[model samples]
Target chain A: MKLRTAFFLNTNKMKFITLIVIITFNTILHSQSQTGLVQYGHKQSMGMGAPIGIDYNANLIFDNENSLYTFAKDSLEGGHIRESVYIEKDKDNFFVNSKITNKLGFQYYVDKENKKLLSRDIGFNYVKEEIPTINWEISDEKKDIGSFECLKASTEFRGRTYTAWFTTSIPLPYGPWKLQGLPGLILEAYDTNKEIYFYFKSIKYPMDSKIKIQKPNSESENKEWITFSEYKKTLINKHKKAIENGRMLIEGFDSADTAEDKYTMGNSYIEIFDNE
Target chain B: MKKILFILLCSFVSFGFTNERIEPISENESAEITLPVKVETYNFPYENGTITLTIFDNGICEQGTVTGTLSTHCDDDGIADYVWSGTICREHIDALIMQFNASC
Candidate 1:
């Protein structure tokens, strides 16, 4: 007891903050206030134009007022595919593997009651922004997916036109990977170009005690939250660097004509264009 | 990448003729130069595999697990030797070089 007290005294403020987080975490786990959790299979095209796209698992965990959109556990391990362009001294034909390297490391935390959206991107930068509105064209076309009747809805989001199937039976607007504002729980989604696909895999009506929805960096003092403008600026700078590196790699290659192709290069991203 | 790895392995597995040079000297000089060298391979490691490096007195440095091997001079500078690390999509690409206890 004396040793524990000494340790706490040595790092008083940090320990106190950690203690609060621990208590809150335990309470969230044990309490009956949580709602549901769902898993989705996310498919993305390999950049080098390989037919077999990489697959990932994403999760949507929700309570009464908040939801967390993030990657599922162990999903990213086998999902990574890197494109390596090897240029030989004499051989001009360079082999470009159908390696898709675009993956989002951003986690979205939505505050429904407060109408605020918080996200942590690139593992460190915490950004707060208003939720972008998606103008969905809901149609009466209906289909049954896993015993749930779903309606077809299409929306042009960020540069991709996506068709989503949401079931009104659940009466929840939660969905995977920021595809939200639905009339009900989204079960499946796919882009028009077939480059991106998301499908509902499983769900727990009441989230398991072991399952957790992470609180944003605002809960911790070590992280200082930034605005979306700041986050966008940082991303633009990173994007420029990546383009520069790609150009350098392509400069000496004989097959320079195909240098800008996404399959031979990994410059393509999920958001083809994002004005906001 | 595959061809490079195959060629490296082939060169290393050559019967007795590698692309390395070593000239024999007199018996008296050889006797004075003979010394016991011990090396233990430690993996600093990555999620995909281990980042292991083992160096010899004859300027032969072999990297295990991942793909690397270069002829370089060395001395055992312990675990905290010059760390060369980068990221393979936000995750660390941890690489370490183990310096040997002998000079080339």
Candidate 2:
């Protein structure tokens, strides 16, 4: 009878140990999957002097080594505004490709260890760019974004003067789109002209989400590998060629030639073209 | 037993909540529009007719009229009234109108 009681107690102890093990495993799995959502606003000229702005909710899928940034479908007003500008996922391979004609959404993959950045452009070109080191002039200006007290900083990048507000409390050197290299997460960034802006909406940390950082190799289309500088050169060439052909592709006017009336807006690049 | 079956039915019904289908333009068809108020016409599955939406650059809808056996039931049931006459943001409104114009 004593042996039988010992055996029963031992079985209960093993069951308790197994339950603890299962709970611990679940906690680890949950911690590994974290996603942060940033609602960003993009303002650009759909036509000359016709600036339009739209709000985009994007996700920053974080892992130990890397993060994936992509736009979430607009959830406002029952998604009344369809996601016209977005990356198309190749169904067969699940590789996301940019729409070349519009060049709407670009993808960036950052390697934290090596500080290397890989960006895929509209024409399916993979540009390996070194993460730009910005010399930000931190200012005494202070403001509150949500509950965090953010500090003001300014820097010039790619011919555009940008003013950024960052919060060191987050401790993650990240930002919306390709804007990073700050001491902390960039809460807001915009050009002097306000032509480009990324404003923080909200953040959800310790989230239960998994982000599969997709590899660009799954693409069926021939991946054109180029540096960021080379890709810029190609982009400039494409725009110039389009202008030289005596026609420009306007947003709404498909196949309708409005070049005579200047209905097709020229490239409103924030950085003025310099001879240098 | 009846209560259990009813609860199961409610759970199944709750699972049916999904985004309303907004079909995109066809391959051969272009989604471009002429400035002021011109758009290519197409059919929406929910609506019984070919819908043509006219809007300004600012996203103000002047028209969201339909022809041939039109029904407003699908849109009336939801927050999709902006498709008809309300001033919606033009960026998504253009695409939404274009999608409504396209038939799945």
Best candidate (score: TM-score): 1
Scored against the true structure, residue A34 in model 1 reaches a CA lDDT of: 56
Candidate 1 Cα deviation (angstroms), residue A117: 1.6
lDDT of 2 by residue, A1-276 (tens): 999999999999999999999999998786665444455554432221222333445555555566555442233223434332321122211111111111123456677788877765434567787887878899999999988899999988776678899988766777766777777777788776555667777776546676566534414446566887776776556444433322211222221112232212122233333432
Instruction: List pairs with backbone clashes in candidate 1.
Output: A47-A100, A47-A263, A48-A263, B75-B99, B75-B100, B76-B99, B76-B100
Best by lDDT: 1
Q: Output DockQ, candidate 1.
A: 0.02
True contacts kept of 1: 0.00
Q: What is the DockQ of candidate 2?
A: 0.02
Worst 10 residues of 2 chain A by lDDT: A92-101
Across B46-94, the per-residue lDDT of candidate 1 in tens digits comes to 3454333332222222221122111111211101111111111110011
Candidate 2: segments with Cα more than 4 A from true spot: A1-35, A45-51, A54-56, A71-104, A215-220, A246-276, B1-104
